[model samples]
Target: MSDASFSLNGTHPTVNWLGQVRAPGTPGSLPLIRQTVVEAAETCGFCDEDVAKIEMAVGEACTNIIEHSYSTQPLNLDIEVKVGRYDNRLEVTILDYSSINFAVDQMAAVPLDDYIATGRRRGLGLFIIQSFVDKVEHRFVCGQGNELKLTKFFA
Candidate 1:
């Protein structure tokens, strides 16, 4: 929990629990990231099922950052994770620093049925993430970095 601030619309504070993790952008660092997110979600009163979903969604985001964005290089970049509990919802953001040019916001998850038909062993990370979370938002700042925002509402 550094001196970083969490604001929803860039005006007011939105996060109740704020945390940041600096890990080598590699697959070996994913478990640490997932553990942190699960703990945060649990503290926010998320049920077992919802907690598992959050873990998987955040893991998917981290996997992408490791495998694609950072190219499995040194984990020198700052990978930030923020967990915020709203009145009726919980929001989580995963930020990473990378130079890879990607349009995650404009990409659509391949349909599950189609994915299954193709018999591809991998490539459903984003789809699984989108299916579990209520909302997913992606943003890439020109000089800042990439942000993958995940939101889940309590029922």
Candidate 2:
């Protein structure tokens, strides 16, 4: 599904947009979702630098979802990318069917020096999302799915 849904929430109708992209859990589908997110952020008046940050963070999150959550069935899984704008923030909610419980508090940021010295590349997506966005809310409904809400506030 590549259709976009629009809605206004406590903001000007013309300034708010919501788009959804559904794809199989694979790396190849990331660019399309990333582009959709970046375009939505741009429409919210985000500068180039901020838009790039949002793109990078969203890309990392999507990658993690596909890599970790759907490792067994990456090509057959359902992944959804929801992009929206409201007030002074641009938000993106990524919904996935994976039932893994995410612990935000336990996913602390590693020191730059330690990460560089170790040269290890794992468990960094959540950190990137936390650092790039002003607010993050995660919800896992018993029967529905996991919702990762990322919000980047305008400066």
Candidate 3:
């Protein structure tokens, strides 16, 4: 079964991505995730440049979900990737029923001397997502989940 499917929501096209994976491993589902996401992005009529950005951003997003979200046990992960073209822009949104478990803030800012000393990679996913997209917005839903949106303006 595929995690994503295309449907028409009024005038625009939509992709509903849904699936789950254990923390220990993503199984063979990882490829499917990439394929579906890439296809949806392509559907937005992105050129080579956009493709490169999508490659990185999508990989990072999927990796984050696989590593942080549900524990090793089989946990439900519902991901929705919607792509649309309007006003010469491609907008992509990734919605997941997951949470950020790592010390993101500490790692990102390097406020502590220790963090600076360690020089550990931080905000890699978020930074890449922000860099690749024109804009990003995130919101947390108490019981439902969280949403991370990325948009790109194309010529």
Per-model lDDT: 0.79, 0.77, 0.58
Please provide, for model 3 over 1-155, each residue's C-alpha lDDT reduced to its tens digit, 9 standing for 90 to 100. 25455667676555444332222225345566556556756766678677778757756765666667645425666555555455556655656665543322223422445555787866467566656767666666766665666667765
In candidate 1, what are the lDDT values of residues 1-36, reduced to their tens digit? 743446767776455664556676667788888888
**Cα RMSD for candidate 3?**
6.2
Question: Over all chains combined, what TM-score does candidate 2 have?
Answer: 0.82
Query: Model 3 compared with the native: what TM-score?
Result: 0.61
Candidate closer to the true structure by lDDT (higher is better), 2 or 3 = 2
Tell me each candidate's TM-score: 0.84, 0.82, 0.61
Total clashing residue pairs per candidate?
Answer: 1, 0, 0
| Poorest 10 consecutive residues by lDDT, candidate 1 | 12-21
Error of 2 at 19 (Å): 1.8
Q: In candidate 2, which residue pairs clash? A: none
Give me the displacement of residue 3 in model 1, in angstroms. 12
Better of 1 and 3 by TM-score: 1
